[model samples]
Target: MKTSVILNQENLGSVLSNVKAPTYDRDKVTTSIVHIGVGNFHRSHEAYYTNELMEHFGVLDCGICGIGLLDYDRKIYNILKDQDGLYTLMIKELDGTYTAKVIGSIVEFIFAPENPFAVIEKIAHPDIKIVSLTITEGGYNLNEATGKFDFSNPVIIEDMKNPMSPKSVFGYLTQALKLRMERGVGGITIQSCDNIQGNGDVAKKALTNYVKEAAPELLSWIEENVSFPNAMVDRITPVTVAADKEILKEEFLIEDQWPVVCEPFIQWVIEDDFKAGRPAWEKVGAQFVENVVPFENMKLRLLNAGHSLLGMLGALHGYNTIDEAANDPDFEQFLKDFMDVEVTPTLGDLGDINLDKYKKSLIDRFQNIYIKDLISRICLESSAKIPIFLLPTLKQQLRNDGEITRAAFVVAAWCKYNDGVDENGNTYEIKDAMSDTLIRAAALSHKDPIAFLKIEAVFGELVNNKRFVETFTNTLNMLRINSVKLCVQKINSSSTSV
Candidate 1:
C-alpha cells in the first residue's frame, strides 16, 4: 500500500481492496442540496444517508454540494477538494468490530469566502431544491431572551446593509434567495440541521426577520413560497484528530485526510413540510413525520441534557472521555436518576418509546468504549449549550413543579468547573465565550452562589426565583468544598434509592 495512491476518482477502483467504495456511479450524480458549513457531523450523518440512498434506490440527484462559509472552512475545502470530496466513514461498534467505507455523496466543495458569487449562483440555480445548514446553534445569531434572530449582531448589521457581500450563513441564504427571485426560480426549502428545537421554524423566523427591511417584497414572496421544516438530528460523531488518521492507516490502509469516526447509531427525524419538494429520505432510514416534537423532546431532555450533566463533571473529576465518566458507578447511577426523575417528567408523551429502555440505551451509547469522544469537546461552547440543552428542561421543571435538584447540580458544576481550579488544587484555563465574565462571576459565587445566575444573558430571571436560587447555592457549595467524586456519590445515593 503506497502513500502515492491518492484517494480520489482516479484511485476509487484501486482502494476497493481496503475501503468499501460507493457502488453508485459518481458521474451520474447531480447536486440537489447545497449544505453550508460542511463539518464532521454533516459528513458522517447526511452524506452517509445520501450515499445509502444512491447506492440502494438509485437516487443520485440529491448529492450534496458542500459549502464552507467561514475562513477556517478553507482547510476542509482544500482537503476535501483534493480528495474529490471523498472520505472514509469509520464506525466503531461495542463488540470490537468496526466498518469502514468511502462515502462519495458530496460531489462538490465550494469555498464561499473566496467566491461567494459562484456559491450563491449555485444555490439560486433552479435545480438546487434545498439549501441546508449544519451551522452550530449560535451560528443562527439568535437572541437568547427572545429566541429570535439577533438584529444587533455585528455580522447581521453588516449583511443587512450590503447583502451582496454576505458574511454569515443568513447572508448567504438571503442573497441566494434574492438571486433566485430575480432569476424567476421557484421556491426552495431551507432546512436547518442545527440542534435547536423547532430548528426549521427558528431558521424561518431568522430569515423572515432578517430580510424584512432589506427586501420587503422578497419577504412577502418568502413568506408565501419558502418553507422551513423543523427537524431533529442525532449522532455522536467525535472530532477527527491527528491520531485517528494513523488508526485508519493501520487498520484499513486508507490515508484519508479527514475521516469521521462515530458510534454505530445514527438517526434523523424531520418534519415533512418542504414547500418545493424533498428527497425520499425515509427510504434511507430518515423518518419523515407530520411532527418531530416528541422525538425532539425525547432527545433534548434525555441525550443532550445528559451530556450537560456529565461533561463538566467529567472534566472536574479528571476523566478524559465520555465513556470514562459514564463507566463510573456513581456517575452512571446519577444519570439514570437524572433521566428517570428530573428529565423524564419534563418530556411530553413520546409515542412508541420505552423511556426506561431508551435511558439504558443512552447509557450504553455514552459508554461506547471505542468512540473515545472528548469531554473537552463536549464542553466546548458551554454558554450556548446551557441555554439550548439544559435550560428548556429547567424552565419546564419549574413550571410543572417537577424535581430540579439534579438540573441545578449540572449548572452548579458547570460554574464550579469555570473557576479554573479543581478540588485537588490542580488548575485549568476557563474555556467559554464569556470566560472573563463567567470566571469573575464564578469567583464571586464562592461567597454568593447566585452570582453566576445574575448574568441575564445566560441565566435570565431564574436568579430571582427563591427555589432555584437556594437549590443552586447548595449544589455550588457542595461541589466547591468536596471532591466532585464524593458529591456525585452523594447525589447518586439518593437517586439510586428511589
Candidate 2:
C-alpha cells in the first residue's frame, strides 16, 4: 500500500511519481496579480494558466495573490493557507482517465475580512500591476431591474461612509487606487473574469459609480489610471467534496484538503488591453483577442444557456449530475435543439470558430461522465442566470420570429424547479440568494400561471409580451401536470427543427 502525504511545498518532492508538480521554484515567484474571489473556477482556469506560464515559459513574475472577501471565503482561506497556497487540480478526461497536477501559481492568500487594509495595501503595492476578479455574476452589485450598479446595498452604503475601512470590492478598489495614485504608482488593470456579458464595462461602471459617490475627487484619477479588460473564460469546475480528497489519497497517495476537479477542457479569450502588463498566457493556449464580445456571446448563449436548460430540467427529473441528464437521449436532443434552433440565431459573428462543431463539443463536454458536475451547481443561481443566459435568446427569437418553444420550456421548468420539490416528491433545498422571493413568486404560479414572470428583476418586460406570456403560461401549466421528462420529450418531438 502507498502512503499518503500532505500536499505542501515541503512534500512537493514526495508526491506520487505520476502526478505532475510545479517545476519552478515557488519561493522565487513574486505576486504581480492580485485576484479577488479565488473560487474553484479561478483556480482551475486563470491560476492554472498562470501556473503553466511559470512552470514552462519561465514567467515567474506574474504570480497570483488570492483575495477572499466574503465570510464564506474563510474556509478556502484557511485551506489554501494551510497548504501553502498549493493544491491539486484533477482534470477528468472524457475517456474515464484522470490527470493530476499541483498548481503553485497562487503564491499567497489574504482573507479581506480579517484585514481589509492589508488587501488594499497589497493592491496598492507597485508590484501588483493587475487586480483581477472572479466575483460571480451577481457580485457586480448590479440592480437586476435597472441593469445598472446598485448603490443602495447596505454594504455599499457602509463602505461609502467608511471608505478607509471598506467591505465591498468596489470600496477596496477605490481605496487601493487612491493609495496607488498618491504614491505615484503607474496605471494598473482591473480585469473581470466573470460570466456576465460586457463584464469589463460592468466593472468599470460599478467601480466608477462607487468612486463618483464615495470620493468624487478620485473619479478623474481612476479614469486616467485604471483599465478594465473583458475576458471570456470557460472551464467546468465542480465544487470540491470530501470524496475528491479521498480519491486523491486512495489513488495517488496524496492528501489535499481542497483539490479542484474539472473537465479536461479550458478556454480563455481575453481582450489584449492590460495597462501595466500581463502574463504571456497566449503561450499556454489563452486567446488574446481584439474584441471579446463575439466569443463571449457565443459562449454565454450556447454553453451557459445550455447548462441552465439542462440544470432546470435535470433537477425536475431527479437527475443529480449534468452528465446524468445530458446522457439521456431525450435531454440530449433537447439541448441540441436549444443550441441549433433557439440560441444560434442570437449569436453574433464568431470569427473562425465552426459553430456546428462548437455546439457539438459543448454537448460532448456536458456528457463527460467522469466530471460529475452537480445539477445543483449549475442550478444554483437561476434567478441571475436566466436573464443573462436564456432570456437574450428568447427575446431575439421573439423579434426574428424564430423558435421559442425550447426557451419557453426552460423558463417554465425554472419556475417549477423553485417549488423545492422534484416530480418524484423528493424535496431538495433551493440554493439561491433570492430563494425566498423566488419561492414566494413560484408558489403563486399555480393560481396565476404568469406570476413568476412578474418579478421585474428577473423576467423584465417578457412578462408583458403577449406571445411569450401565452407560450410560457402554456408550458408552465403543462409542467405543473406532467413529469419533467414528458415535457422535455414533448418539446423535443414537437419542435420542427428537430
Report lDDT (CA) for all predictions. Answer: 0.85, 0.90
- Taking all chains together, the TM-score of candidate 2 against the true structure is 0.98
- Judged by TM-score, which candidate is best? 2
State residue 152's C-alpha deviation in candidate 2, in Å.
2.1
RMSD of 2: 1.4
**Residue 81, candidate 2: how far off, in angstroms?**
1.3
The regions of model 2 sitting more than 4 angstroms off are 496-498
Give one digit per residue, the lDDT tens place, for model 1 in 343-449.
88878778888988988889999998878899888887788778888888888888887888888889999998888866666787766767888889988988877
Taking the tens digit of each residue's C-alpha lDDT, what string does model 2 give over 1-498? 668999988999999888999999999999999999999999999999999999899888999999999999999999999899999999987887779999999999999989998999999999998999998888888877678677878899899788888999999999999999889998999999999888898899988887888888888888888889998989999989888888888988889999999988999999999889888999999999889999999999999999999899999999999999999999999999888878887886776889999998999999988888999899997777888888988999999988898899899999999999988889999988789989999999989998999998887788889889988888898888888888778887785521
Model 2 C-alpha lDDT versus the unseen true structure: 0.90
Compared with the true structure, model 1 gives a TM-score of 0.96
